[model samples]
Target: MKKETQIGYRVSAICGAVALAFAGLHAMPAQAHGKNDVKHVLLISFDGLHEQDVARCIGSNACPNLALLAKSGVTYTNAHTPHLSDSFPGLAALLTGGSPKSAGLFYDVSYDRTLYAPLDSTCTGAQGWNVVFDETTGIDAKGGGPLINLDGGGAFNPDAIPYAKVGGVCTPVYPHNYIKTNTVFEVVKEHIRGSRTAWADKHAWGYDWVNGPSGKGVDDLARTEINSIDPKTGTYYLDTYTHTEVFDNIHVQALINEIDGLDSTGKTSAAVPTVFGTNFQTLSVAQKSPVADNGGYLDADFTPGPQVAAAITYLDGALGRVVSELKQRNLYSSTLIIVTAKHGQSPTDHTKLVKNGDTLTKLLEASNYLDSSGNFGQNNTTTGNLNDGSGLSGTGFVQTDDVGLIWLRDQSQKDAVVKTLKANLGCTAPGICADGPQAYILHGERLEHWFGDPANGRTPDIIVQPNPGVIYTSSKSKDEEHGGNAPDDSHLGLVVSFPGLHHGGRTDDRYVYTTQVAPTILSALDLDPDLLHSVQVEGTRTLPGLGIEHEHSQDRD
Candidate 1:
């Protein structure tokens, strides 16, 4: 038998329900309910974390905390993020239980149909200007203008904006504007009753939107700012914090003060949430481990590897601290801590991939596809021309970290562009764009598998995938990146540990994709996993061993 299967069998037997505990590590399962039966679910996400890196942490003993958590939780051997693993969309999935296919969040800068749905020039209104949803934008473009005080201006400023200055607007959709589906957090509040929650994130776009409001509403749905100050040593250090949470050590004094205020009988007490979590940037520092951090990459230039490791380690430590505090507060065993990530980064060796040399860029450049509008592909005229002279139709191109979605003005011209891309990239028959075994093509519905929306205004006509090592970053930034189908980009780590989790430490090699994360999280929470209207037609299914049969997606190949 294969080594992996053997290991799986052994783990399955060891962690079987009602089975004898291995070395008395965990207690036998029993009924859990009510306030006493409640579980404080903590979903801690380490952004840009890679599955391989987590595995490496286990191998190298770099992340002992995570390793111990893994022992108590079920680890998915096959977990992946979307082809375009950006912070906004990734967090959207975790909170809403849907994919970009449904959410209409293809990228940070996405096209909206409602405001711009009817492409006729006569549809004039502020909504038309609110084409792309910005996380900072709290407006509902479909509703004509900003929704709440927070919409146009407030403590939480989520508003619709344009991708560029010239043509169509790229509105920024926040949790309120972005998510149309029911969220697990909402479900949790619905059934559980009397569960106070709190959350903190450094990323403007990152948050558990379903369970918490975007800004100012939840007891503590604000950002946290962290500084790696050695309070014990009275020394300054590098640390991360969100916008509203504990700042440098001195700022945290206020939090301490607030807690103290809760005790003074006559003193007014700031509301303290029963369930609260805040993110830090210490791990992000690790993922973007600079030369000062003693990892790869030179000064000013950062690699994703060390930074990812650091972020994981930082969160592990923070989680440990939180867990310890909870235990001290006598809420340890009852709390369900779910440590996860918004999404993982697509590991890129920019230095090598660029040097290997491919002609696709040059071909596109020669055809004036790169900068159609002379505004350097910013807006307006850029969206109208550039391909087969089919007027302004072929101007749609969504550039990602390692792929470019080219929408042709005319469907008939697609084959010609495909041929040109193939010839330039040197892709073989089966491959799409062949550039020294580096580039591949994804067309039609197959592309839809990776990207939820693949046709009409939702889909890109041609997806340009770079080689594994290649990362198609914009000219401005030269650091870490994501948004590709490469194994390094799509692959991520998934650890599920909760009251009803049937298995632990057992690896499931059955193929899994990023799209499944939504349904899986929903199922684990015992919520319905309906693929939202914003998502593609298909929905993710519960795994076989999880005590429920679920719909499994067919193999892409």
Candidate 2:
């Protein structure tokens, strides 16, 4: 039997088990809300927002709208993303109610065992791995062409794409069909009648992916590719402006259209979605800008630079517009607003910037582990010749940000690789080693503890933990990067608000993972969180102190 066919049978068996489990379960009665009660959830994420940035802007005119929301809601001061915080796994945690361990997502470009390399036809290995839908895939080579046809709503050629367990089918998978678990959107749609969900994200591919394998979770998905540099004009002018704030306004308009019973494309007669929201990118852009006084921080204080301050103010105004639109449509008091971030930017202090540093890549190259054909940092390598499997086959591939995830072609070379990395990248300085600015190596059991075991095929063989500001890019474009266990990267801003909550306007200092956002949304809608596969699989609980509780009657097991 073919691997694809075997995977299909295995999936059918799992579905049978799930159906048998559901046969013994009964749907919980919906909690009746009074007139003027919360009936909708508007979940908004400000990508790369730090908790301190919110603190610094609160009570100031720069972020009056966010301050108002915080004043009317419960703010979680110590909320965090997962330890291996990349945008893919970060948002996966938010939507799937589990970390990468349960959700089976590591990053946008990650490794897999039971998959073939779509770009490399000559690949032959027991474990095939390659980049998913990143830049190197040539999906967007025409600079937002049919391969990236979020605007035209066209699907990619499945034959030329890698396969994954999406929508219960192990066929070729698109970016929107990669997640292995059900999302809150899928749960709400399945259980709730007359419920509609809409979302806008940095890429059209992002929110669609969050809708999970079924592809029927969200009713409206708006695509605004933030990173697309136009092929003709060589600018990002189609979806962005000189500032990300101007770019985010496009999403703001889409949200308003959704509120006004219209789709993101200005289609009239669209139903107002029950759950709808979008993410903002201004703060993230500000944090990475090289221009002086444009970044998110100036000194020890959280005071943003001039451009950043303006971006915050503009974002506040955008929030005010959303609130005003809700009130105009009589939807304000009855709607739950969630203000949080997908991930946080690292090195809030500009003085911590490290540049022209490709230390880890050089070390791997010296050890003959890195493939000589492809470029290391940005994903603009030659097509067809790219390594179709993990570094263990011919040469290895290394993905580096503040942290380094190394995939080796030969597992037998693990010891030599670790020894070489420790000798070169490991830090021994006293204060730096104690966490100020240091490097740590994780392999064997330690790596498995934080990230899942590499034997599972998704986890990397080795992880290079550099100090807080040690980015492994030689490019001078951006000052800071993420995807590390550093405090600046993991710590995030989280606020939840709804009418009639007891702890409104209060601050909660308890540590919470962003994964709690998924189950919490299910609980708010009076639905069982266990409907989401990962919530049940991982035993993920709702956010603490949500005030509203549900009967744990569903037989998720």
**Which is the leading candidate under TM-score?**
2
1-557: candidate 2 lDDT, tens digit per residue: 11110000112334445544654352211122342255678998888888887877884656877877776677889999877778878888888888877777777766665564553333443334554544323334322243333342333333225654434444555565567788887787777678788888776443457778887888887755665554455556333224466558878999888888788777676877777888888877777776453555676566777756776777778889998898899887778888888888877777776654666766676667765544442233333323222223223457778788787767778999877765554433211121344557779997786667777666788877777776777666677778877888899988887655533566777889998888777666656677788878777777764433323323221
Candidate 1's TM-score reads 0.66
- What C-alpha lDDT do the candidate models reach, one value each? 0.45, 0.66
Give the per-residue lDDT of model 1 (tens digit) for 248-330. 22222322332232311214454434343444444434433333344323222233345444454555665566555555666
Q: Which portions of model 2 show Cα errors greater than 4 Å?
A: 1-36, 119-127, 135-153, 157-160, 164-170, 229-234, 237-241, 291-293, 372-395, 426-438, 552-557
Report the C-alpha displacement of residue 129, candidate 1, in angstroms: 7.5
lDDT of 2: 0.66
Candidate 1, residue 33: CA error in Å? 10
